[model samples]
Target: MQDNKIKQEIEDVELIIGKIMQIGVLIAGAVLIVGVVALLVQGDGGYAAGAHPSRPLAILAGVAAFKPYAIMMLGIFLLILTPVLRVVVSIYAFIKENDKLYAWITTVVLVILVIAMLIGYFGK
Candidate 1:
């Protein structure tokens, strides 16, 4: 009985995680579409040849300025962020289930992901 209950709860958590991924992807796709439409209407990407916003602040500023490339980049960033969000949700779900081993494992994975992102951002 206890095992069945735990399994059910885990299933619920998985469903929530699936929904998160689905929504994230959908939103990112929509943003990308909007950016594409804007680019087409404007007849330009609004950036110099070979120039693009690489930093978060620059991206945000460009997005605020309604730059199509920045909007598309934001969409790409959100797409990349979706799986990382899933890992975070998994960590919370594991901790909630009192599953110490899985919780610690997920935490380590999250840490590694953050480290990798930092390295990539800085190495650029």
Candidate 2:
């Protein structure tokens, strides 16, 4: 009974992770396509580099201002974050399984992922 329960939980986690990745990729791809189409239609496909945002929030502001580059960059950002979120789901799965060792390892991996993101954002 216990073994079957664990198996069921593992299967459920796999399903959830698969769905998460699929949705993330689809959304990112759709946004990228739209941005590309917008750029192609405009013919120039260029923006003033001086007006480009230096951070995430600023990039969001740029997107709100209808900057094509920012929109495409946001799609790229979503693509990058997809795997990071997979690690997050894995951490939860590990916790649910009561596997302390795996949970700790996943937590460390999550921390490392976050550190890398912070460095990428701020270590300029």
Off by over 4 Å in 1: 1-5
Q: How much is the lDDT of residue 34 in candidate 1?
A: 86
Compared with the true structure, all predictions reach lDDT values of 0.92, 0.85
- Each prediction's number of clashing residue pairs: 0, 0
Measured with C-alpha atoms, the lDDT of residue 38 in candidate 2 is: 71
Number of the top TM-score candidate: 1
Total colliding residue pairs, candidate 1:
0
Q: Write the per-residue lDDT of candidate 1 for residues 9-88, one digit (tens) a residue.
A: 88999999999999999999999998899899988777997788888888899899999999999999999999999999
lDDT tens digits by residue: candidate 2, 1-124: 9989998998999899999999999999988887788778775434664454557997687678767777788888889889999999999999888998999999999999999989989997
